[model samples]
Target: MIFPEGGGRESHRKEEIKQYYRSFLWSLVFTVPVFLIAMIFMYIPGIKHALDTKLVNMLSIGAILRWVLSTPVQFIVGRRFYTGSYKALRHGSANMDVLIALGTNAAYFYSVYSVLRAASSTDFESTDFFETSSMLISFILLGKYLEVLAKGKTSDAIAKLMNLTPGTAILLTLDDEGNVISEEEIDSRLIQRNDVIKIVPGAKAASDGFVIWGQSHVNESMITGEARPVAKRKGDTVIGGTVNENGVLHIKATRVGSESALSQIVRLVESAQMAKAPVQKFADRISKYFVPLVIILSISTWLAWFLAGKFHGYPDSWIPKSMDSFQLALQFGISVMVIACPCALGLATPTAVMVGTGVGASQGILIKGGQALESAHKVNCLVFDKTGTLTIGKPVVVNTRLLKNMVLRDFYELIAAAEVNSEHPLAKAIVEYAKKFREDEENPMWPEAQDFQSITGHGVKAIVRNKEVIVGNKSLMLEHNIPISIDAEEMLAETEGMAQTGILVSIDREVTGVLAISDPLKPGAHEVISILKSMKVRSIMVTGDNSGTANSIAKEVGIETVIAEAKPEQKAEKVKELQAAGYIVAMVGDGINDSPALVAADVGMAIGAGTDIAIEAADIVLMKSNLEDVITAIDLSRKTFSRIRLNYIWALGYNLLGIPIAGGVLFPGTGFRLPPWIAGAAMAASSVSVVVCSLLLKNYRRPKMLEHLDIGGIKIE
Candidate 1:
């Protein structure tokens, strides 16, 4: 029933269309009987003989009855075409509505004229005239009804999206004794930030927030398109409209009402559905000249035939046939107008986009709109943020080197004491490593450390076990006048070559040991790079990490190009540089610092785990933070565009082939002329074909990737 195609809503739409058809049928039932009764009275022997055998003399009863019955039917069924024609005339454009309005009105006025003429002629009959008026009106009404039904079906996607958001929110309040009180509320405005909201299993989340207490598994497939339910725990954020599978969570609401994720998604889908694609613009241009051309052609057809008749010297006796020829020309012109509805042309692109977006949503990818989806298909270069995009973004100690014959426990204890007070991410990594090693029974904690001071761009220094302990890079050791041995220098060089950071540990003016820390590459990172390579898309990595670490991770992920040690703004500049090189770039990242870069790229895709600022800055948001969705998004866009192109071709081709035939272009050569009913049927078939083609998208499947590919070429571990 829905214009474009999909299954679930089809039944409901068919029923609605049936209801409209039933109403139209009842209207026909009432009007057709009256029309027949009026015809009988005007044409019967008794009535005809009483009126001096003249049909026109019986007009007082038949014409009045016909006008009374047809007036309301015309208003009910013909008003849409009338108003549409008026608008088209106002704008100096012609469309299908103009044809319906002209055809139906001509038939009605012709019937009135015939009735008047019949009253003055002794042998005339009203039967021939009344039937034409009734038939034309019925045909036009049927076409209008079909048009309404098709339009309703095509726009159902937006309605389905709007139905996802909940109508009410649960407000949590505190009583005098500080005990919580929950109330089911209808107003979203009553919900505020930091309020504990209880969402039951199988119910949609009222707002976007983080879980404060309890645990549950939420089905975010509505937003992410992942069929599996994601396990939620404390500190994890939950999106609105996602179903809660089990358990109850007291969520501290972070976003409410229109600010919720569900509201934003609904707004995006609605706007995307309303936006037109490139092909529709062509149809609009064609429509602008359609009416004027038809009028000129119809007039010329009448004049050409009349001129030929005069040239043959038979015009005096053939004048009535010339009028009939003009009427036939007018009928053909009207048919052309009525049969060339632009609804299919206009809907071609939007319907494909809507279906593509819905498919992407079901797969955990969120493309902002048709524009973003379209642009993604054209992306030739894909730039990625290194830390969170390729690497795990969490540093771990990968190697340890002893410089002064210090025991492993003693080295770790001293370093842990020195780094425990530091707030840097790398410092925390070292502290955590030391904590795990110190937990062993053989390793004991050192005495309390004091006077901790962190050196910017270097490392930290502190008094551990009553000794001045330094834990930093070689620069920090030299700054404190601590000597580095030849062995320590060799270790640093080897670690640096492997894309690892070396934290130099020195105590009492002597080098002790070094800790090599590096972030591990994410699983399947290399495969994603190879896939891009096969697709002919260039892959590059930008990172704030040192060049050594950047090159190391880049090599591991099969990335040949790397931009190292870039600040947030510098990352955006890199995107601009890529654009200047004439490559359409798609930036992918999941960090706050990547927001500017994301905005600078032609298409920005943010991973779901990314900060809100970064997600907001990007054009597309990937809910699973999986690289596979990037490829899936591009494929979906390409397939959607291809489908639209196919549908547009089919719709335009049908009109192109049928219109000339309908206009009698082939009559002289092949003796073929398209009847009005045949033209109408063909036009309907074209619309239906476009809808069916769009619906076929439901069967489209994502491409499958081969498993168990080796990554040794990139050296990823």
Candidate 2:
């Protein structure tokens, strides 16, 4: 539900992290003293001479002290690995836990046997390895602690998202006429639909609803990534978690609890985080058999070394005179098992996905799922929906001419009344423009429209104030057999030439006036197309507008291809056609009609201001609603996948080299070998390096295309 106050499960995870830290500290405490009392410290040149003398008996004192210190570290601090290993074994699987348990226990049991022999006989040869077992456990614990810390940083975006909502709300008590009488603060969870809430200056909204009274500027940067605060008035919708900058507002809750926008965003981000990227699936497939394979290799290494040591007369001269073939074989096997870590392979992708998703959320780019990020990187062709996408959705009244016997105000009222119920961007613009010129003292009201119907890709039809009113394009007029006058045709041609959509308003089958509406190109639309050209990506404009207007708009934006008179289904067909032509297509749109096309594209990119249906169908949501973010989404995906590839190479290469070395491959030729402690250190380093590399993605920034260029005479001011 995107609760800002973390629930019980999150608290439990925090406790688990604390437990790991405590166990690591205890292991370090005992491991330090055990190392000081064993051969590791005794082998130091100065210490070796002193220990051999009467001051301390190397065998008796060191063996007893190391055994006493190592026991608790092995059993208490390293207990989880044993339990985890047992669980994995019962399930017929092998994992990092199995390696840790096998390597540490082998050295520990052998040391235990040696200590028992030393206590029984004075002639017992010293073979205690308490330091090796203790140090291995300590190192494994340290690695886990670092892993836990790194994983925490990767999820900071989720934490920040949850922090945006306030815990409490000020519920207002209203009188009979819906005027506020009093208010009481209560838990935000208690808020319900239809409840009235009071929001003051500097207070965040408690839920998603409509403001019924008062006015304010709301800062919605957290949700939309827009730096400017949007002004909110009565009847304006306000989203939860946005700050009210001035004045007070009485809002009627339309959506509360899990239905709020913040909750949906959290759900989308969490689902994306949980889903695996395509590259990650390959790594997972490899890891399913990686551990069991490593175990078999370790066994084979031991057998080979043991057979070689006996038949080939022990390759290395550094082995102690007291050690036999069996001891050397066991040591080599333990080193091989410890050095071949599957942890590095398993961690390679999830860490990168987590960091990438987190970074995306922070920038207001919500990747719907990891699969989208994987696919977005390969998009080579982009198809853009014209209205409310490449251009501003708000259509302004550029030029108006009245024809038949009617006042200008009456013509506007008839047109606005027919379009009042529609949710279209052009309809909204006309309604808003009409409201400003309304002469009524009270709230603006238009006569009711009867038999209303909205024609998809055309316009609206209705009977306003018992008079037939049709407001739409030339197609709607032609379909109804309403002939346009010579003067009207000339006006329409001039309007189309000027890149304006002419809304032809008629009354009772006769033309009344022509309202020239122009939805202007969005700032930076041209620059975005220019950048895509430089990037070698093809751009196409698909719209329901007439060819002349469509072509004019496309030319201004630098889009080379234009497909005019396209319905929603035709738009999807265009995307499919592009894919069939061997192009990886990306569809950018921002309306309900765009949902089908969005889903049809290889990568569906929905602008943040788009309808909920469009956003749901889209794989990637650009919160800025800026065309430039299309480039950002693609670039970010490419960079993230690049990092994943590098991680795979590093993990595979580390295992390829280390496993063979730890198996004693060089011993036959060079007589050199990696010790057990050194092998453990290398395994830890491999896992940590993969995680650190993924973390480096947090420093990513968008390309500086606009900052470096001086376009014509206009410097970026």
Candidate 3:
């Protein structure tokens, strides 16, 4: 298991990765000479003659050389395994550390016994296996070094996000009127909320806040995945870490430090990696008892082999002629212990999860945890909220027609004044549309409206320039007893039939004009829906809008299933109904009302939540709100889970097949035997292969959804 002890900071993890690599280097330095003396020099005729000659008074030169070389590797470089194994055993558990310490220590102690016997009797045949113990420690340390390196690559996304924040910021000293009077450069960590800062051209914003002084194009592609730099002006909110590309901007810090966008994203990704998935829990359970059970099997195999060797009188030549029954039994036991260690089983899930979550973060898809990544692969039904999810959330005035003989300037000024104070989307569209008409005038101003009242879901009414002005839909106009002529009514009906919102402007109880407003569908929305359909995913649109408007928008986007006029709670109920019918549902939405349905679905996907990294109910957040990311997310999850399955098969197969062979299963039939050094090499190779397999996910690319056309300047073909 990977331990994130320093709260997921990249520097802390780098230190840990380096520490393992350093330890591995030291182990190899000592183990190589020990290996040559114990395995190579003893087999060479000339070198064996020199080593067999007495160099010292009591000990042979070979015995003294092997002891000096192997002692440091067992006690110094291999000390962590002993301490880790002891701690785990004290807590009534056994892990990979326990298996390593047991296997290597057993081999080391047996070699020490052989060295002592050789010193006592000059003719005692030396059977020192110090090479087995030293090589086992060296191989395991090498596997650990590579594992640490692979794990670090999985957190590269978080590191890149932290690097986006500037080290220093230009803090501004403002006058009483909030105008900048002076500026000083200070560390970014010293910044607080409400502190005004200057962001010059090509500099990153210090914190999340609104632009207070200048205007510029800010590149938010790091968080939103949009390639274009967004236009930022005074009063426009800018996220911290976004760059001011072309203009100098003065911004006040609204959210600093932990509340910044970059900080939240890093925190969320770290938490996602640390949380265990359901399958991960199952793997943990199996590994918890896996080591101890392997120990028992190793002991059982040793006893069975020893009893068979004694009764059969060494009839099989599988046992070496020079070795006794006990030495042969010890060899098989050491092999079994080294081969059955559960390092690969421990690595099967987390390495894959870390790499998968990191890949999702780079694409602006924030998955909350491994459980979400696991569950996302099985989603077959997708439910989408209509307003901000399928169509552009902002409404625009499409066309306006005059219904009364009134001054055009006067009509625009009155409507703009009445609706300017309204916060509704349609009202804001109208206020923005009227501003363009006044560009020719030198100083065109809107008269302040009095006694203003906004009718929710209807429109606004106010007294503008001593005239009673009311701007609303047909229902609001009829509620106030305003008479509409046949021509105006026909115009309103025509716009509504085309899935547009009709706003009626009435001055002094007389209908003056009808404004056609519509929330247009987003670009490439139709193509994305078609792509999902071709991928065999069922798409459904759920909204509180009228059936006519909802169906009209759905039909244009190739969505056949429409749940129109459904309230927030009703949307969640619809999701539950689908889930009960044996379909895995993925709900996608952006508004607060969609939170309930987002939580009710199998996987809740929040769209366009660029700076809001902590979307409460969403399992996955698509920062750009692009429909293309929805397909990318599903494709990535499927591929990631598929990689995980392959890893499990390899890990389980390696242990099952390796343990028996190391226990001398083929000796009786094929006259073949496994060696302790070979067993250690196989164990190390198995763990390294599992980590290498997970690293392959870093190269995963989202499948091309629209291969025939260009979307966002990326040609899929």
Candidate 4:
């Protein structure tokens, strides 16, 4: 049930592997005898005497025996190639199948004609090529078997993710009083939204939810790449497929089925594998005309060598001791056709992309596929959001100064009750700080606030117990015509100078107090900026806070460019301006109100803890919510493209050198000629080498500078 949106079955996969094995087995069973009959017996004197004896006129027994064994291999065991070639040619495009089918068919039909002509003549000596056609098909099938096996390893990460879901879970049916009425064991897939599930020690949580009862340490290393166990308590969200270490806990399902994080990851990896990079077009353009060009070159090679031999252009000894000038020319033509492979060129980019994306997923970096990887490698600048992105995102009340003669506890009660309705980080910080004054810590009830309002980029407004209370920045107070005292202005100035957001509390159009809230910089914030500078990337900070507070925070983090007091839409404008300046910009944000900016950048990287819209718009998701992952995403892309370049070099270089030698280009002077079967084997090996070269990316580790970095409060080993 944890299977992705598009369902698949193991039965179908098993059948496909079986089909490949069967084809290879059948080719081997028929091809071995044909090779032995045409090659081995010719060297044995007794068998050579019997092979030389003609059956019907000039036709020998060895030729008839090879013809019977090779016929089935040519027609039956190698039928897939003929079908592939037909499909390719019908679409007006040539592929690897066309070259393979053309080479094997020429050798098979020509040997058949040679046998028929020899039977009709008086003293005709014909060299039948049954071994050549049959062995070529056999070697190609063996190569395919190896290629499929190697390709399966590319999806090992997805398979591991799917297998992490547990089979069953303990379901609990609760009453209106929050008491468990019934408990039963059920399949994990049957869990629905809002359904409470019990997780015991040594069991994985059924789905993503928050715990309503009990506490335990859950190990989430498999999903988020955090190497430690996280403590989960009441009202704390827990992810699916994580192990529960101790203590019995009950979690209500918030997201189930494909909507869970595990399923989303699987879908992302699958999409990445399907999306093609712009660099792949280079190989695609070459493969379209590769076969037809090779066919024309092969025909021209045959005619050149045949006319040379007819007019005695080279020494006669250059021909093999077993055959005449005609056979030498035919050998060169068939070798040329088989050696040039289009498969190698076609596999160069895709295989490397697949391995690179898979390696990224294993390290908790989810890339959106080839297009993202292509853009990320060239990113020279990163735009960072201030609050949640650059800092810990959790603001706390640091200092409070009252301008009016009001009780501190009574003022805070009014402030917390008004700010409780707002979702801004600063509002939440005020509410949390106010909770310290209440004696009822577990469930403190505050006075009801009427007509609550949140002003974007400013603050909030509400009415508490007939008292009109306003909590916001100086702009909100001035906009409402609330006069600010000189003492209040001084307090606000001091708060901004200290890198803290200053909140003005006004009651009945009079400035009452000033509350300074400070959000600490995240661990390694300066180091992140320093490492990005070393990588030749510029760092900029953008925020909705005032210039004084934003500049103070930016200076502490070593950021030279700072944009402050901007609305959500204005953030997107800055991204567009930077992009227009010829910089490949990447926007890193918490996916909150800055979604427009995330969509505008060349590459948008969203933190996993961000809003759903931000994750949807981003090209890469930092699942661990760590700033260091931005560096990992960029470095991974540069390395993957480098590997892709190496693959292309090897694939093209093999074809350039192989095709010429197979055409007997070195034979006339050095008497060194490549046989047709050996050329066929080399062609198959070239394609396999390209795939194997890409598979090496699985061993990729993050850059040395990014190693041993802490993520989500866990010190990874």
Q: Which of 1 and 2 is ahead in lDDT?
A: 2
lDDT for model 2 comes to: 0.83
Each candidate structure's count of clashing pairs: 11, 0, 0, 0
lDDT of 4 by residue, 1-717 (tens): 677342463345456567778998998998888888787878999989998889888899989988998888889989989999999899999888888888888889989998999999987887878899999999998888777777767877777788888999899999999999999999999999999999999999879999999999999878887666889999999999989999999999999989998888888888898789989988999987788899998888888899999999998878877677877887888899988877888888888888888888888888999989989999999999988889888899999998889888899999999999887888999999998888677767889999999887788888998999999988899899999998998888899999999899999888999999999998778878989999999999989987889999999999999999878899999999999999999999884677889999999999877778889999998887778889989999999899889989989998899888988879877898887888889988988898999899998877888666654455544
In model 2, which residue pairs have backbone atoms overlapping below 3 Å?
none
Error of 4 at 206 (Å): 1.6
Please report, as a residue range, the 10-residue window in candidate 1 with the lowest summed lDDT: 1-10
Which ten-residue region of model 3 has the weakest summed lDDT?
1-10
Instruction: Look at candidate 1 and tell me the lDDT of residue 272.
Output: 60
Q: TM-score for every candidate vs. truth? A: 0.74, 0.90, 0.86, 0.94
Q: Model 4: runs farther than 4 Å from truth? A: 4-14, 405-418, 438-453, 461-470, 474-484, 506-511, 708-716
Best by TM-score: 4
Model 3: per-residue lDDT, tens digit, 362-461?
8888888898998898999999988778888788889989987877767888999999898656677888888887888644568999999987546799
What lDDT does the true structure give each of the candidates?
0.70, 0.83, 0.83, 0.87
Error of 4 at 41 (Å): 2.9
Model 3 scores a TM of 0.86
1 versus 3: better TM-score goes to = 3
In model 3, pairs of residues that clash are none
- Assess candidate 4 and give its TM-score to the true structure: 0.94
